[model samples]
Target chain A: MSHIPLEEGVPGIRSLVMYRPDTGKPLYELAQVLLRDESPLSPAERELIATYVSHKNTCKFCASSHAAAARYLFDQESGVVDLVLDDYQSAPISDKLKALLTIAGRVQEDARTVSDEDVALARSFGANDRDIHDTVLIAATFCMFNRYVDGLATLTPTEDAAYAQMGERMGTIGYVLPQKPA
Target chain B: MSHIPLESHLPGITGLLEYRQDSAKPIRELTQLLLRGESTLTEAERELIATLVSSRNQCRFCTTAHKSAADILLGESETCEMVINDFESAPVGEKMKSLLAIAAHVQKNGKNVTEGDVIRARNCGATDREIHDTVLIAALFCLYNKYVDGMASFTPTDPAFYKKLGERITTVGYNRLPGGYDQLKTQS
Candidate 1:
């Protein structure tokens, strides 16, 4: 149950966003731009960044749903999503992505703790200014999102299929505002 | 200076926003809606929540910038300092204290905010909207604090800078600044 009365059966942030469309609209727009719109980062990589941060925050709904989306986006390389989630260091991904994820993890734990060495490491991996900036922003944004969903204690559906559908929708269509229940 | 090359004259989030206008657009709109949009919580109250969370996150740029905006909105009372230092002991009303408590918990970790905290806020005469907005405001600043600090963006040392910036926030709002980032360079 959510902290406030929300439309029944709607899950996670969708319910919360429906609860306040004024604030929700901007949030959705931000997500769409960050995850789907034109950027140096591919949609798969961006989704992975969001998933990585949410997993660190222990935000079950965000983690599961985003992980599913990352998997969908990764397609043939889908297995890497769980591998990175479990322990990114050993995950079979590009060194550049690993470096970026390292920075993202640091941002999740404590932004101030993300030292110069971290930025240098990402740059060494051929990450440009945009890459590093987007990675940090993505991580930071998810921190806000993770808290928003859990702070209200929104409903989290239990089944894997639920997340699979969410993952596919996010991977394909990107983020859009959840409409109010009719 | 930021971790990446940015307009040297601009400070904090202004420089970052300039760095990527595409992403910055939505972020700016969200800030406008969360902080300046119509709500039961006054702009001052919302700014207070942002200041408190930024202070806890130890993001000097965000803490100082928002604290100044909150001070101007609060006018003569200027309770932002005390509130940031210790909202629990601050002289704010029960409703505000309760909402700040919720905001504080959200700052530490979302799970830290228990159901009891929400109920207590309700008891303090906080409406659902107030509680909801408080959490969102706190959450939003967490993003801002991290974004500013994560990249090691510039943090102005002069108090005067914050004073003017604060005035700008209250007057100009988040959607559009008076002179925009390019003009911010000359102002300081």
Candidate 2:
């Protein structure tokens, strides 16, 4: 088995956060607000979006961790989650969700890449201005999150169990933690 | 006068787009599609989110170009665009707009971020899915745009007229030759 380098092991932006967890408190707090905050999107849907982008970016750690979070949200079979990650349009979701995910893909590209036709399609599915705004925000944020993690060569736990553990923690306690292990 | 470093002195991302006219065609095309793609977001709003995130990341070139784009869509007299970029909560359009701007700020951070603050902010107007999807998309693309410009070290350029020029270029043709200098010529 090939041993991964120490610098390349941590997942997401944990290293950057860990290095300045004290300083990053504000940032972490903000994240909690965004996810746990009141909105139409459920925790599961949010995680699913993150998972989708992580999968697209091919970030192993984000993919695993977020996937675990999403799986925890759903009480049924994991096939649907898998399908959403693979191809959201064909997944077992409403037209609204399909429209949202389509916007997410555009976010992965350039904003200019998204077109009026795309907006009209979503509108046909009944996506309002708020929904549109949030979609762009999510896509744009993930881009930065992905970079911050990959940029620092953060460690990504490979074990499925590890991510599962994380999922439980996130689901139960939200994003903030009393103590974090380095 | 301090001479600009030859390497760092390229116009800007927009300039490079013009400079490397051929290669940039793809990104320009991609930008157009993204701006007008089938999403819930409007072209102006989408561009605003992108510009805000780029500014937070401190990418001078992207900030310049996207802001220019925002100004064009929103209008030159719009101070709210600046408010959004300066701080998501700096008193802008509406609760929904604030939510989107805040989402962009969070994107500059990382995803391990969820708390009552963002929730409360979104609750003011944003939906749960909106917050979630916003963060996801913003975070994902920040990586991409950054990767491209960072890797190639693309120059950032946006003039008072650049936005209009970009708008024209975006609408008309990205490659009919803008009628300029040899420096505008790309490596290809």
Candidate 3:
């Protein structure tokens, strides 16, 4: 009953990473800049937002992978991820992070939904202008990323262990092309 | 200068979650199940789509997190995430991803973008009724998440470290709560 011809036999990262290199040059460059560039937000916080937003969206791939990464950052603290995933307002975190996540949520729903009060709250938390700017970019970019993955009818690994392993490698290596699927 | 009260933070998963929990929540729950539960689409692909849609919506929280996670799922390969953050045409995958990006673009711009050609392209990618179902789900979530984050005005962390942390987080675990911020204030 599925419309797309999903190559289920491909297996894990190998199957998902099978995009044309030439086709993805620009996107690759942008992602590199966004993830690796010198910005105000920490890598962990940024990724946390991504995971949180994905969870809100209920994107399984995003929620699982980001959750693993978040756990790695906080030393396998599933509670932190759960807090954000379950209810950011109730999550035990800095006011600044809460402010940022709040902004991220707005980006997920509607940019116009972001109000002046939101900016002032972020300011109170010591978030600078650049940090605020980057937040918008991160939110915007995720929207694109989420659609891209889901749109393609791409494969998701069934095993939780697989995501954990992938998280371990990703945590250390960042995003480099793997030779084969682990 | 702000219209809403900066101090008035909405507490605890919004009353919406609680209300839905009491009843058999339909919309959000249905969306969550479709997104996280078993389906024809792969987890990575679905995340990719979610990330892409969030990115387009400028949802820093969702996009950055999912990008890193997507990176891991792809064996730390930045290609797919890259394609998502910027150009969709650049390929490491299929036309379907690109097409869905188009759908996200439509979502970003508004309903005016649902063109005939785009629909045809989605069809070509093997996307069908279910795929359409998922796409709508992905698009709708970004809208909701964006509304929450934007209005609340949450901050985003830096990038270099964000990526580093993302990679480092591969093995730890999931769903944690680090206590520091004050409890949510109820304003009813």
Candidate 4:
């Protein structure tokens, strides 16, 4: 049971968002822009960053659903998503992405700890200002999202299929605010 | 002195928002809605929640900026500091104390907040909206703290700057930067 009364059968942040549409609208808009909009990073790469942060935060709902989304976006390259989640440093991805993930990981643990070297390292690997900015923002935003979902103890459906469908929706349609329950 | 080439003239989150206006739009709107928008929680109480979370995260810029806003909204300079230092004994209402307790739990880890905390807050007269907003505010500040510090954005040392910034946040609300980001750049 959630701490507050939320729409039943709605899962994760959806339930919380439906509970308060005014706040939810901006949150979903931010997610849509951050993940789905044009940037130096692909939609797949952006979703991977969100997944990595949620996984580190130990928010099962965010991690799993985002992981599924990342996988969906990755398509035939889906194995890279799991590889990055398992251990991004050892994963088979570009050095630039690895460097960005290093910075993202630091942001997850302690933002102050992300030193000048971290930024320089990412730059050395071909990451520009926009890339670094997007990576850090994505990581930071998910921290809030993870906390929001878990803080309320929102429902987390316990099945892979549910997450797969969520991934398809997120990957295909992007983030849309859930309507208020009728 | 930021990792990225943010506007040196601006300070803290101001510089970050200027760097990327597109993302900053929703972020600013969210802040305005959460802090200045309608809610059962008073503006003072909401600012206090943000301050406490930033203080816990140890982001000096966020802590001081929000502390100033909270102080002004509360009309008492000491309560914000008192709550940041030790809310358990701070001179606030029981309802605020309980909500702050829940905010504290969310700051450490959202899962740290238990049913007991929510029930206690309700018992202290906190509405579901208040509790919900409190958690969101706390969570939102966590993102802000990380965003400011992760990029190592500027942190003004002068107290006068924060005073003006606080007044701006309270009076004008958070939707737009004073004079807009472009005008700010030209002045500098």
**Cα deviation in Å at residue A19, candidate 4?**
0.8
lDDT of 4 by residue, B22-59 (tens): 88989999999999998878899899999999999999
lDDT of 2 by residue, B1-188 (tens): 10111233334444434433433443444444445544455566666666666665566566666666666666673553555446545445565465565555455444334354465555576653344334534553464354333323444343644565557533553333556435444532
Candidate 1 per-residue lDDT, tens place, A90-152, comes to: 999888899999999988888998888888888888999889999999999999999999888
What lDDT score is found at residue B143 in candidate 2? 49
Best by lDDT: 4
DockQ of all predictions against the true structure, Cα-based: 0.85, 0.07, 0.09, 0.85
Q: Best to worst by DockQ, what's the order?
A: 4, 1, 3, 2
Instruction: Kindly report which residue pairs in candidate 1 clash with one another.
Output: none
Query: Can you tell me the CAPRI class of model 2?
Result: incorrect
Worst 10 residues of 1 chain A by lDDT: A172-181
Q: Rounded to one decimal, what is candidate 4's iRMSD?
A: 0.6
- Candidate 4 regions with alpha-carbon error over 4 angstroms: B182-188
Per-prediction interface RMSD in Å: 0.8, 15.5, 12.9, 0.6
Task: State the lDDT at B133 in candidate 1.
Answer: 88
Per-residue lDDT over A80-179 for candidate 2, one digit per residue giving the tens place of the 0 to 100 score: 7788987787889778878777767766655445556776787788776545544554554456566445433357777789999887777667777333
Deviation (Å) of B155 in candidate 3: 24
Error of 1 at A128 (Å): 0.5
Off by over 4 Å in 3: A1-17, A76-78, A178-182, B1-188
* Pick by TM-score: 2 or 4, better one: 4
lDDT of 4 by residue, A109-173 (tens): 99999998999999998999999999999999999999899888899999999999999999998
Write the number of the candidate with greater lDDT, choosing between 1 and 4. 4
